[model samples]
Target: MTRKEQTRLQVLNGVLEHQVTVDEAAQVLGLSERHLWRILAAYRKEGAAALAHGNRGRRPANAIPLGLRDRVVALTQKRYQGINHTHLTELLAEREGVVLSRPTVRRILVRAGLTSPRHRRPPQHRCRRQRMPQEGMLLQLDGSHHLWLEDRGPWLTLLLAVDDATGTAPYALFQDQEDTRGYLSLLQGVIERRGVPMAVYTDGHAVFQSRRAGRDETNRGGATQWSRALGELGVTQILAHSPEAKGRVERANGTFQDRLVSELRLAGASTLAEANQVLGDFLPRFNQRFGVPAAQPESAYRPMDSELDLGSVLCIKELRRVAKDNTVQYHGRSLQLFPSMERTSYAGARVEVQERLDGRLLVRHREQILTPQEAPALAADLRAQVAEGPVVVARPDPDPTDWNPPQRVKTPVIPGPLAGDSIWYEDPARKQVHRDLVLAGMERARYQGKRIGRPRVSERPEFEQQFTVVVERIGRGGLSRRQAARELGIGYATLKRLLDSQEKSCTKPATSLSLKPDTGEDY
Candidate 1:
């Protein structure tokens, strides 16, 4: 017997010998006197064998059969090899007519040395933040691109919005990829279904923010397209510094990839439309199963304002100048603006072109909505009216034979190549000219060498002329050479050279004159 049975047998033997009372034995075993008496009677009859449970060695009536276990294992290893435990359990019940609970299926598979395909890592340590007190206070939005349709369809990005308070996914949409338009449509749908959220928690995606971060964004393309949309709606945008900070939505992404992918496989959804349909049908059930009530009863969502027009607010707007012919060209499509009552024509005026989600191009001058008609393309007509080549006409009798060969001069003279030009030194006249030029350059270099190029201010005649007057002023002991240099807009070295070039000019910025460290630099 095990330790518990051994203990019970030891206690009961003492009670049978009358060495211990039934009350003490019951208290020691944490049992009542009546139950202890029954155990004592059975122990007296069967000795140590009665200490064990009667059904310990017997098979349970509701136990799963060995045959069913074998068949489940066989099917798991054959048909559902790579499926997770929960999904395999579901598949077995639906496809194989096997009525087994998930735990039973997991037990059978694990006993047969089969493990679940999905391997989850251990959780890491992080600061856990509390959820919002009420719904609509904050919404965590993110995009997860995965094989949601597996190999049946193309890869799609699921733009999901999860409410922070209740952990409910308010809205989600399948997109070709995570783009600004997809996010715009997502935010628009959320604003229509649920009211405007107080703030949004999301990652630092390009759609939600600009790449030129922490700088003057106004000059650098301002904000991103989605950021502008959020600003128009007056919603606060919160950027998550790391994935762990937004773990709720990130974990939701992981959960959906695991469960939703299997659900799509079960529904046989092979196209984007079919996948969306399945997701729509699954969202209600998912919310009911997973969503929880918030800490606060009242919602924090601000109700939609009746005056706010969602179409104009949530759209890609572009500023286009109206053409002189009363047309606004957007993406090569000419939108001809009709004259409204306020103005005769929109030509020479600026207008905003809003590209609505429903593929409608709206031209607006601030608040006035102008009617626009698409001008037909002129490419085909222009191509059809093209001339094949320049119009041809016979040359006017070739100028009546200027080939009369100008009998005055039949052979025109042409200058021959200067083949002997490289031998210029051999020419006595050219050599004398070059010699004189070299001698003249050497004489100038020797005579007025300091005045050849632009000279320093010291070498200038005016600086030398003003030297005596500056020295007389500095001799009064008020101004320094550095101060004089500053007032005259010249370097200290230039001023000192100008002073030293004259006779007995020693009020200079030199080491001999620098009696103290502050000597010629005093103001």
Candidate 2:
């Protein structure tokens, strides 16, 4: 009998002998006197055997069969290789029609000495920061580039946002890459659905923060397009120093990588659109299952102002100067800004050119939207064709010579008769002063050891005398060109050049032998 049964039997024996009262035995066994009386009756008739539990030696009613457990282990080792225990449990229920909890499946595998493909890391102590008291106070934004469609489709990046307060995903989408435009669209969706968040927590991705590789953190440098968009919407952006700093989104990425990939595979989502559809269906359930209510009921998210347009706020914005032809060139495309009611032309005006999420180019000046037609190919020539006003031929000053072009001639320095009405002569005093200033500037530059002009061609190198002696030796048949090159610490080409130059300077006969017959090939 089990120790618990043996103790109960001893207490009942004491009660029967009158040494232990009914109340005392009941208290010892932690049972009511009515139940104790029933136990006493059974023990008096059946002896110590009645103390054992009735179902102690019987198998549980819901016990899994050996065949099913073996099948699961075989699948884990073969078909479902590399699948985690938790994911395998779900797949078993959905596909294999073998319903089981993760721990039950894990138990079967552990008994079979089979382990999960991925191992859990030992938990480390970390000081987790408390979540924001209200939703929309802080939302973690991140993008994960992973094999969402496995081998069936191209790799895609999933842009995700998780609320710090509720641990719920507000909006997520798939993109070809993690780009400035993708994050902007993500923020736009979140804002439209749940209102504008007070702030965002993100990593130091180039989309979120301006690159300052060699600069100090104290120097923020400048706002990136994403940061600028947030600023325009009055949303504060907090850059995380490490993954743990933004653990909410980082851990969400890991969970999606594990579960979402399996979901996409199970749904047979082979295309981006199909994957997104599956994702859309999955997120609501995910939020419902995992989301918790915030500590406070009131939402921290500020209501979007009716006047503030999300399309204008959440997009890539750049300062573009309107070309003289009233156009803004962006990414090899010309955005032609037409005249607004207040202005006749945007030419020479610095305007904000926004590439909206819908791929529309918006040019705004002083918050006024300017719509312009897409100038066709060779737009510059087209603008030149459409003149703003009348074509006026620039003519000379209104006079007798207005019909004739004025002729210009220079007067002689010696006061000759070459001067004309439109002619002008150089001033001698001004020229002298300029000359003096230039000379003084050159002297100052020379004193500062700054080179004044193109490097002077060396008339003669300092070692020319020594090189000349070596060349003469080679010419006199005393030293070979190779020998002379090594002795003078110069190359064979240099020695040969010296020999040729010496022959020309001294008018001496050539004494060096021709090294090789010309191949007659152009170098």
Candidate 3:
């Protein structure tokens, strides 16, 4: 019996035995005198059983039938095995016509042990930075490498930017890899659609900064290519020293890995373009579901500067000095700058060559775009075409009788006993005699100090082989040189020197592990 039922039985017994007054029973039970009287009368006739609820063991008239419940569970196990309870509920309503709320589905699945809450590690205690007061105040940017298309296609990288204040993803695109051009395309999309953010938070990749370990801070003060582009647009770039510092974007990447991958699979997206098209349709629904309102209703984003040229601001720019003939060299292509009205000649002047995102080149002089033509190659180089230009010399015919060459002399040898009258035939005894004679001569020459042939790697000291193993292991495992040296019983400085030499000897990169800047397509 419930505690309420037991309490009522006690109250009625107290009143019937005259141990407690009727007024006291009513006050204790928080019921009126008249209501308590009715209950006491029923209790006296019906006994303790009357205190129980009348509908306790009965199903309601509106309850779903047993067959429907069984079908729902069976369908979940068969067709939508991995679907979560909430998504399954929607699918059941739409496809199976079994209307149910998420909580009801969750309770049914939990009873069957088909689903359970996810287990997560306890969060570390750290002071969290508060979100900005307004949207667009700070934007966290990152790229996630994931198998977004599942097995239908190759792995792709999703470049995204999330507004820190509102938790809204303003820009995201599917690309072949995480590269400068991809970031540029993302930046352009954001600027054209959502306006300029006040500041961007990112990690210290080579695309954002120079990553020279031994160089002083002052030496790396000059802006990188991407940084310079951002500076030209008046956007502040904030570099994060650790992953925890950029927690917003990092968490977004994790969430995308979970939700976006499933969405792409459901959409049957098999290529980058197909994934992007699906993403375009998915972002709006996602933002609507996950975006939070900022403290202030007003947005913090500023309007783009009218004079800014996005084409010039979002490209690879390199400074080249013009030669006396008005030629500038860039990536082995010589571009001849034409004279404009502002200047008679650009000879000996430094000009900027911009490689636009669309793979077009533009030469800019004093903030002015110039027409560039391919320069004619010089005559001194044989690689330059000379068929239509000039002939250096005339061909002369040679007389065969006038050409005298050196005469050859032949020496004859008498055939040996096993010669078989063939030049290739040789006796085994004679070969063995020649080998013994060479060995004897070498033994005699040893006293005079002589060595031949290259040394074998295995012949080196044992310590050197260990050093090589430790170095290669460190490179693969990403261990520090000091830690590796300590474990291998070697000096730290010696191991460091060996690593430096190995890096110098490697013309190509050992692995795609370093945060190097990527120069490729924007899409």
lDDT of 2 at 75: 85
Clashing residue pairs, backbone N/CA/C < 3 A, model 2: none
lDDT tens per residue, model 2, 186-252:
9888988999999999998888776764363322356677876787889998989998899999888
The global C-alpha lDDT for each of the candidates, from Candidate 1 onward, is 0.77, 0.78, 0.76
Best by lDDT: 2
Query: Each model's number of backbone clashes?
Result: 0, 0, 0
lDDT of 3 at 175: 91
Q: What residue runs in model 3 are displaced by over 4 Å at the alpha carbon?
A: 1-83, 86-99, 111-113, 116-119, 213-221, 342-345, 373-523
Candidate 2 regions off by >4 Å? 1-62, 74-81, 90-97, 212-221, 377-523
lDDT of 1 by residue, 62-135 (tens): 99888999999998877676688887777787789998988888888888899887898998777779999999
Residue lDDT tens for model 3, 289-322: 7898999989988888888788888998888889
